[model samples]
Target: MKIGGLIKFTLIDFPGRPAAVIFTQGCNFRCRYCHNPELVYPHLFTEPVPQEEIFSFLQRRQGTLEGVVISGGEPTLQEGLIPFTADIKKMGYAVKLDTNGARPDVLAELLDKKLLDYIAMDLKAPLDKYSLITSVDTPPEILMKSMQLIRQSGVAYEFRTTYDKEVLTDADIQALEKLTDKEHYRVQECLPVAKEKAALKVLHKEI
Candidate 1:
């Protein structure tokens, strides 16, 4: 767990449950409208928060916080994710994972082991516009598989899009809907946020 930052308590991140959010330090996607550029760009990364300190806090918050949100810079990049999550589960908190669906293999393993209570995948764009939006070459199959896994895993989940007008057209949004289950999807307004304050603000509002 290369933790860049931690929100000790949050009401909106885990839907109905109050939870603490751990923002991991690396990302695979480079979305143009992403507010957390400090987490995405390696040169902007800060020293990671100590895992011992994080666990100790979680231990103290056991009864107060009902859930833990493993957010990113793509948490699937962390090799310690499984054991870290297992440790939190042992602490009696539900775990929700927020991801870009870049790692279906990791998602599959977590689902197979029943490790997640909820999963939220960011739908960056329509399949054809993915690379244009992310500024990286992405395999559409990867996202497609990840979506399928989340949909069928029996784990509660949602697919969310930032809905950047500069990047996505109405047709693109409609096309994105076809790529995911509409019942489990949402579109969030894209806001202009300062990079420094964005971390705290983005967590309060949807991306």
Candidate 2:
């Protein structure tokens, strides 16, 4: 629970439920279009938010908030994540995890314990192009294992991709269809920022 940031409350994070957002610091990947760059790169990390403060706030909002969203720098990266999620479940709050699907083991453990109510796993690329999008050395097989676990878990989940010029294209979208079942897929328009935004605008104009 190395909490780097906290959104006291959020209405849109968890589907159909108001919840608090717990942002864990330090991501494994570094996407250039990433809006939350601070959370990804430790060089940009901010002061750590006390876990007690976060729990106290959740305690106060217990009745009002329906769930909690564990998002990151990769929530699964935190060693304290499982126990922390269990604590939230103890409070009778549903938990939703936003992840990159790198750690199927942790995800499976949480699912087995009923610690996660929902999951939204990001599909960085169409298997072959993951490294290009994530700016990391990711094995496509590792992510596929996670996807398989998610599909077999019988939990509510969606696989999503963020579209950006350097990553996806019309052809790539069609290519992605062959990578995974369409029933579990979603394509999100990339909302860029700073230099990335400028790059995307140029790409949009060209399109």
For model 1, residues 71-165, the per-residue Cα lDDT tens digits are 98999989999889988898899999999999999999888888899999999988888887799998989999999999999999999999999
**lDDT of each structure?**
0.88, 0.82
Lowest summed-lDDT stretch of 10 residues in model 1? Answer: 198-207
For model 2, the stretches where C-alpha displacement exceeds 4 angstroms are 195-207
Per lDDT, the best of the predicted structures is 1
What TM-score number comes out for model 2?
Answer: 0.90
Tens-digit lDDT track of model 2 for 132-187:
88888888888988888888888888888888866688888877766677887888
Report per-prediction Cα RMSD to one decimal. Answer: 3.1, 6.3
Question: What pairs collide in candidate 2?
Answer: none
How many clashing pairs does model 1 include? 0
Top TM-score prediction, candidate number:
1
What overall lDDT, based on C-alpha atoms, would model 1 receive against the true structure?
Answer: 0.88
